[model samples]
Target: MSTLSKIEPTDATEPVAEVLAEVKKALGAVPNMAKTMAHSPALVRGWLALSGALSVGVIPAPVREQLALATAEYNDCEYCLSAHSFIGSKVAKLDPDEIERARHADSADPHAAALLALSDAIARGRGIVEDAALETARAAGVTDAEIAEVVGNLALNILTNYFNILADTDNEFPPVTPLAHA
Candidate 1:
């Protein structure tokens, strides 16, 4: 059971209902995470705005999904892990091996590996990232714009992860392998 009752689209009010409509249109359904967030209409709005901005940012969709997966795994959030895994595979077309590697913040692509390492560092370091980590990302051809996008993506995913943990939101998407810590 969830710690809070999810506000379903049918029961949502005003702004929440409007946002839920858009979410459903974009995602094919209102994910439980979004529904749980609808408990606070402002949060759902803010999340939608941030998510929309990040969708067109410099980072490619696959890398963004990879970062999300890595952040979810690091945070031990089952809801986010499952959600991102589904989107990462079906929408982003990431291979099973890529998704598995992403969970550990490792990737076969050099540039992606560096960004994934930085994503893990940001989560583990609590935003007190070391200079060497930044340098590594730069050396791997991650530009300033890309770095900023990575940070944004990490923040976005972390918000969902923390929310899912607090809400204990029911999984509405296909389940992924459980994290060892979970």
Candidate 2:
């Protein structure tokens, strides 16, 4: 059970209601995470702005989804792990094995592997990426613009991961396999 109450569209204030409508239109339904975020209209708006902008950014959708999966796994956020796994497979066309590899921040594609490494480094290093890591990403063909976008995507996923953990947000998407940490 979530500690925070989700703001339903019909019950939302003007600003929140508007944002919920947009979320509904885009996703075909209001995700639990978005609804939980709607508890604060400002948060919902800020989330939507950043997420909407990133959706059209340089990084392709699959890469973005993979990065999210890797971040969620590192952060140990069950809600995001489940949500992104579903989105990655269904919307981003990532296969099961690909999704598993993404959770480990490894990819078969050289370029994608580099980006995932950077994403993992950002999460593990708390955003203080080393010069060598940046060089690896650059050598893998990630441009300065793409690097910036990857950082943005990392931040975005971190926000949701932290939110879900803090709020104990219910999983609305298909369940993903739980991580086994030894």
Per-residue alpha-carbon lDDT of candidate 1 for residues 1-182, written as tens digits (9 for 90 to 100)? 89988888988888889988888887688888889888787888788889889999888899889999998888888898998899999999999999999999999999999989988888788889999999998999989998788889888998999999999999988876557864
Worst 10 residues of 2 by lDDT: 173-182
lDDT score for residue 106 of model 2: 93
- Give the CA lDDT, 0 to 100, for residue 8 in model 2: 77
TM-score of every candidate: 0.94, 0.94
In order, candidate lDDTs are 0.88, 0.89
Relative to the true structure, candidate 1 has a C-alpha RMSD (angstroms) of: 1.4
Measured with C-alpha atoms, the lDDT of residue 144 in candidate 2 is: 89
lDDT of 1: 0.88
